[model samples]
Target chain A: MKIAIASGKGGTGKTTLSTNLASFLAEEHEVVLTDLDVEEPNSGLFIEADLVREKDKFKMVPEWSADECILCGNCQKVCNFHAVIQLGEMIMVFPELCHGCYACSELCPTSSLPMIPKKMGVLKHFRNGNLNFVESRLDIGEEQAVPLIKQTHKYIDQQFDDNFIRIFDSPPGTSCPVIEATKDADYIILVTEPTPFGLHDLKLAVETMKELKKEFGVVINRFGIGNDDVLAYCNEEQIKVLAKIPNSRRIAELYSQGRLIYKEIPEVRAELEKMKDLIMGKMKEVVK
Target chain B: MKIAFTTKGTNWSSAMDPRFGRTEYFLIYDDEKDELSHYDNRDSANDAHGAGPKTAQKLFEFSPNILITGNGPGGNAATVLEKTGVKIFIGAGEMTVKEAYEAFKGDTLKKL
Candidate 1:
């Protein structure tokens, strides 16, 4: 089963929860901790993974040969993205605006358009014991993370069958990149706190998952610190509270020192173990 | 020649509203004549994407030799305007239409 741990607000315990959950599950199952948060992935910090493979991700842009230029404005008309342009005697393509749809090339009368690859990012695969850590890093100054995330998912060697347990640590927010990461998730775990910002963004995250028609559960980290608004909302909405980790400075210290919470707090491991069973039960309920 | 400045709207109704998309009160100062004239653009509503070619087509109706805006002129829009021999000034933040005209006459219109 593919599980996604996501949060709409940053600084929520998504990475913390994902790291411990993947590590805890790895002992009994063939696990893949895929960090889909390409922009700022930190899952590897917790897992002792060695980089095994690296590959480049590319985006497509329009390429026109000067010799075949008819200067017809047809290419410019069909581009819904406003990416193509027809100069007096030339056709030019902007790398950023092109969505790689190739509509311009199809519409060009001279058939002068060809796709040129624009390198966007790199994908790195790491193996540590039983767990596989996959991360995609966007190139510096690159604006798009969608292609890289898609590339990372595509590059995974495993076929999409209900076999191994896969936990995806997704990027924050309900933006396009977040949507890209969580779209194919069979189950979504929204990690949130009891803070006001957490509750506010949690609603957005819940709404997004509802829109995507994904079965979701909430995990409240820092459970005792903030107000009860999140619990109140979850109760009103009938959203299940899967697990809760009380706010502790020791947990925060362990996290900053790159230690998994379950590894540090023996009691936390038991909670995560129970959390996994709860998740399994919830998944069965939804699928049935 | 007259040009119009209309901010993007919030909804379909506002976007389609003729009063919201085009301005008839635009004043263009002809450098040679040293006088402001009523400049209007009536086509901003017809185009979507709000960039490149669509924007150029809307601005072309005003017969503007120059365009000043925050977004850099380029892509399909810039190419079309340049084909008509119109200069594009990107990063024209907070500058009113009259100020842009003065900047154009003084040869200070920065190219995108």
Candidate 2:
């Protein structure tokens, strides 16, 4: 089953949930854990996976040629990214503002435009036991994470087989990067806390997911500490509460020490298993 | 010796004169004799897009001795304005039309 574990807010244990689920499922089944949070991927810190492959993600930037000399301003007009500016007899490309769409070069009237490949980010994959942990890192000062997420998903799609249970750990919020990561998942696990801020963002995420027509269930982390607003919202929206992990300093301590919750609280493995079963049951309903 | 400022958004226009990028204002100044002129941009609204080329063209029609803006003259805009041989100043800040004219007249304004 292709499952995506996402959260509306950061530090809600989305990575903890995703990594543990991957580790537990890998014991008896083929599982792949993808850290789609390209900004700061922490999945590799816990999972003792051996590095096997490293791939660089590239974005297109304009390469100017002074030999073919007409200082036409067509390239400047076509650039929506504001990366290109035409100077008298000279054209300059700003690598920072570029999204690598290549629209500038393609639309340049002077067939003289050259498209150059610039490194936007890097993707690294590691393997431990039966699980594959793939993580992406965007270059410093790069604005867009959508391309990195898209490229990582493409890598997963190429290697994914019918049998492996793929679990993607998506980035926080309902922005473009988040939308690109969760698209086409068989099931989505919306990991959220019970705080008012969490509940507010959860509604936004839930609305976005519903519009995407994807099946999803909510997992409330630190349930006892915050109010019952999340549960109330869930009940009102008829969204299923798959599991509730109570606020535990032990879990937080274990996580800070770079240990999975299932390792410290092995009994939580049973809970995850049960949650997996519930997700699978919903999957059956979905396939029907 | 009226100086025309480009009513566009950029460091180039601001570099030349204070009121270059400011909305609802224009800076017209004479540095040698310290004379000043002010015009509201009520007549100019479409200046942000296309990198101040058309707006610079419009300002040049006013026959200013010096042009101040936040962007430098490197593109076709520079080529078009080179014919007038007007002094170009890039990277002017938020000096009011009258304030910039006074600065130019006082010869205290430094080129950025």
Candidate 3:
């Protein structure tokens, strides 16, 4: 089953939960942890794995050629992105604005615009025992994270199957990147804290899931610091509180030192076990 | 000669809006007609993406020979303006439309 651990607010223990859960399950099952947060992938920091393979990722954008003797404005009209514009006998293309839809290129009578591949990021695969970790990092100054995230998803789909437990560490917020990461998820784990900011952003994420009509549950991290507002909200909304990882100084210290705590901390490992059981139950229901 | 200024209001004394893409008002001055008019840019102000190119397209339709603003247009918009033969003069920072127009005439403002 494919699972995605996501949070609307940053630094909400998504990396913490994902890394621990993946590692804990890898002890017995084949697990692949793919970080879809291309902008800044942090889950690999905690995974003690060896590099297995790496590859470059690319995105296609139109290149406008002023030659061929046609002054038609068709390129700009068909380009909904405004990436292509006709300017007094000259056709200009903005690579950053192009969505690679190929409307302008396919519809152009003169074939003045040709789509070309542009290097956007790199994808790396790592392995440790039964666990496989994949990370995609966007090149410096790259603005669009959705394309890289999509490419990473494609890689995961092509390499791993339903037999291998897949967990996607999604980027923060309910933006386009998050939507792409969790769109095909068999189930979603919405990670949040007990604070007001956490509750507010969690509501936004909940609304987004409702819009997408996906089955999702909540995981409360930093559980001891904030009030019970998050739990109350979840109860009122009929959402399950899957697991809770109490806020601990030791957990933070070990995480800061780039160490896995599930093996060292019994309570944290028990929470991961709880999450594993819940996901296993959901997977059975899905198969039924 | 026709000049366009990204401004906060409709008149010559209106304050210049630094950004070209999301500026509130675009004031066009036609030297031959000696007439000034305003074009509202708020239609695409909340646009999700490509606001720069959209604003540049609007400026292209106006057929201005010059554009003055606090900050110049971005890469995408710059391409459109450059292809359309619109000479962009930036550094109008915090100047009124009348002052900016004088600065343009005196060649004091920097060209983008």
Candidate 4:
């Protein structure tokens, strides 16, 4: 079953939950963990997966030929991103703003604009025993994450097996990258805190999941630090409360040191196992 | 020479808008014809992206020789305006469109 762990607010322990859950599941079942947070992928830091392979990610950008080019300005006119611009006798192309749509090349009357590949990021494959970890790391100053995330998902789809329990650690917020990560998920575990900010963002994420018609449950991290507002909201919305991980200094310290809490904390491990059982039960119901 | 000013209102008395892409209106003043006109720029105000170049394209349609505004045009918009050979002037923040145009004529506004 393909499951995604997501949160609307950042630093709400999504990596913590996803990494621990994957490690726990790997004990008895084959697991594939993908860090879809291309901007800042840190789950690999906690897991001892050996880098098996790597591949560069690329996006198509317009390359203009000045010799065959007529400065008709049609390319600039058709470019919604303003990536292509005509300056009198000169034409400038901003590949950073280009969305790789190839509309500019199609609109060029002289056919002087050719689409070329530009490096956007890299995808890495790692393995440790029964656990396989895949990560997408975007290059510095890169604004496009959705494309890289989609590529990473495509990689997962190609390599995914029926026996593998796929867990995707999605980026924070209900943005395009998050959608790309969670679109194919059979079940999404929405992680959140009990604070007001967490509640507000969780509501946004819930709305997004509802719109996408995806089955999702809530996991409240750092549960006792704040009030029961998140649980109250979940109850009113009829959303399932999968687990509530207590806020502990030991876990925080372990996390800060890039250690998996499930390995050291029996309580966290038990909660993750329970959450896994709940997800498996839900999957069985769907299969039935 | 035709001059364009990013403005909050239709008239020359309106304050110059600092944002080119999200400006409420663009006032075009034709010095040769002694005519003044306004184009509503509200369409691009809530644009999710590429508002700068889109607004620059709209302003280019008026064939303005000079653009006076509160802030410098962004990279994309600057590229479009530069292609059209339109000179940009900044430092219209505290001045109304008419006052800014006067300052431009008086060679007081900072050229961008």
Candidate 5:
């Protein structure tokens, strides 16, 4: 089953939960861990993986051919993005503003515009013991992360095996990139804290999950530090609380040192193991 | 020569809008005809993306020889306007569209 670990707020332990859970599950299952946070993929930092493959992710953008000799302004008129502009005899194409929809080229009477490939990011595949790791890194100055996230999922789908357990470490927040990462997953695990900020964003994430109609559970990280409001809210909403990792200095220290707490803390490992079982049971329930 | 000013209202008495792309209206004054007209910029103002270039395209229809506004146009819009031979004049902050045009005619506004 495919599972995604997401959070509405940043630094709320999405990477921490995802990397540890993936490592814990890899002990008993064939696993593929995909870090879909192309803007800042940090899950790979905690896991030891050898780079096995790399692929360039490209998006098609329009390129104007001024030589075709038409300044009809049709391309500019058709572009909703305003990436195409006509200035007397010169036609300018701003690829950065292009959404790659090809509306300009489609509507151009003279066919003066052609869609061209623009490199957006790179997808890297790695192997560490029993786990296959995949992550994407967007190009510097690239504004769009959704396309890269989509490309990463497409790669996962093509190489996915039914026997392997898939884990996606999604970007934080309930925005487009986060939705792109977690949309197709069999289950979603929202990692959050018990603080007010955490609870507020968690409510938004829960709303987003409901809107997407995805079955999701909550994992309260740093459980001992804050009030039980998150638990009460989850209960009120009929959302399952899958696991709680206590607020511990050791876990925080290990995380700060870029180490997986599951390897060092048996309690954390056990909690994650229980989470994996719950996820399997939940998937089975859905299958029924 | 036709002049366009990003404004908050349809008349020359309206304050020049600080934002070019998201301005509420563009007041176009024709020098030859000595007439003033306005185009609603609400569509460009509410555009989720490319408001600057889109607004520039909308203003291009008036064939303005100069554009006067509180601030300069954005990069994409500037590129289009520059290529179309429309001279841009900025620094009309807190001034009415008529005053800004008067400033432009007096060569007091900063050319951008």
Candidate 6:
């Protein structure tokens, strides 16, 4: 089964839950956990594994060639991003603004604009026994993350078959990156805190998930501390509550120390078990 | 020489918008012809991204010799504007279109 653990607000235990759950699941079945948060990937911190392989990821951007020289200004007209523009006798291509759509390059009458691969980030693969962990991190100063995330998904798709139980740790927010990470997952586990901030962002994530028409459930982290508004909201929406990880000082302490809490904390382990069981119950053998 | 001022409105008395990418209007003052013209930039609001570059592309049609705004164009927009030889003058914060034009004539606005 393909599952994506996501949260709308940052610092709501996406990495913590992913690392613990993937590690716990790896004990019995082969599991692949890929971190889709290209900007900042923290799952590697808690995962103790050997380096298996690594690959550089790139995205295509248009390059202008003055040699081909037909100043028809077609590239500028076709480019919806405003990445390419014709100014007087010169044509300029902004690599940062280019969405790699290839509209400008493909439609250029002179073939002056050619698509070129630009290194955007690197993906590292690590393994420990039955678990395979892959994390893609974008180069600093990179404005876009969706392309890198897309490439990461491609890497995961190529490396693992539908038989492998794949889990994705998605980025925060209901924006492009989040959507790209969870689009193909068979089930999404929305991790959320019980505070007002968490409730608001969770509503956004819920709307986005509903828009995508994907199967999903909720897991409320630090449940004992914040108000019951998040739970109340989830109840009203008729979404399943997969598990509620109670507020615990030990869980926070272990997590802060870069340790996976499932092995040490009984409460966290029970929550993980509940989540795992719920996922397993609804999952099909080839669900992806 | 033609100068472009990002303004809140078309009139000379209108305030110069501090924002370049999402400016309401671009008021052009033709030094040679002593004429005034304006382009509505309200359409930029619909752009999800690249507003700066889109604004620069729109301003390019006016072929302004200089662009005077509160904040200068960004990296992408700057590249397009620079190649077209549009000198940028910034730090015209909260100045009216007419006042900013006079400031440019007096060489007071900071050239970026």
**Inter-residue clash pairs, candidate 6:** none
Per-residue CA lDDT of candidate 5, range A1-288, in tens?
789999998889999998998888888777999999999999988989899999999998878887775688878788877777776677778776777788888888877787889999999999988899999998987767887888888898899766678899999999888999999988999999999999999999999999999999999999998899999999998999999998999999999899999988988988998898886776576555
Off by over 4 Å in 1: A157-161, A282-288, B1-95, B99-112
TM-scores for candidates 1 onward, in order? 0.78, 0.76, 0.93, 0.88, 0.87, 0.95
DockQ ranking from best to worst?
6, 3, 5, 4, 1, 2
User: What would the per-residue lDDT of candidate 6 be over residues B2-100, giving only the tens digit for each residue?
Assistant: 999999999899999998888999999998899999999998888777888888888988989999999877777777787778899998858999899
- List candidate 4 stretches off by more than 4 Å: A66-93, A104-110, A282-288, B102-108
Q: Which ten residues in a row have the lowest lDDT in candidate 2 chain B?
A: B8-17
Q: Give the fraction of native contacts in model 6.
A: 0.64
Q: Could you say which candidate leads in lDDT?
A: 3
Give native contacts recovered, as a fraction, per prediction.
Answer: 0.27, 0.00, 0.68, 0.32, 0.64, 0.64
Candidate 1's TM-score reads: 0.78
Predict model 2's lDDT versus the native: 0.74
For model 2, the superposed segments whose C-alpha errors exceed 4 Å read A282-288, B1-112
Best candidate, TM-score: 6
Between prediction 3 and prediction 5, the one with superior DockQ is: 3
DockQ for candidate 5, C-alpha atoms = 0.54
Ranking of all predicted structures according to lDDT, beginning with the best and ending with the worst: 3, 6, 4, 5, 2, 1
| Candidate 3 segments exceeding 4 Å error | B82-85, B102-110
lDDT of candidate 2 over B21-60, digit per residue (tens): 2334445655567765555554435432333343344455
Task: Give the better candidate number (4 or 6) by TM-score.
Answer: 6
What local lDDT does model 6 show for residue B75? 76
User: Which pairs of residues clash in candidate 4, taking residues 3 or more apart in a chain or in different chains?
Assistant: none
- Per-residue lDDT of model 1, residues A1-288, tens digit only: 778899999989899999899988888766788888888888888888898888888988788887887777787788765567665566667666666778877777777898889988788888877787888887775656777777777766353345567788999999878898888888999999999999999999999999999988999999898899999999999998988888889999999899988977876887798887976675566456
Please report how far candidate 2 places residue A220 from its true position, in Å: 0.8
Candidate 5 deviant stretches above 4 angstroms: A66-78, A86-91, A107-110, A224-226, A248-253, A265-267, A282-288, B93-95, B102-109
Q: Could you give the interface RMSD of each candidate, to one decimal?
A: 3.9, 7.1, 1.4, 2.6, 1.5, 1.2
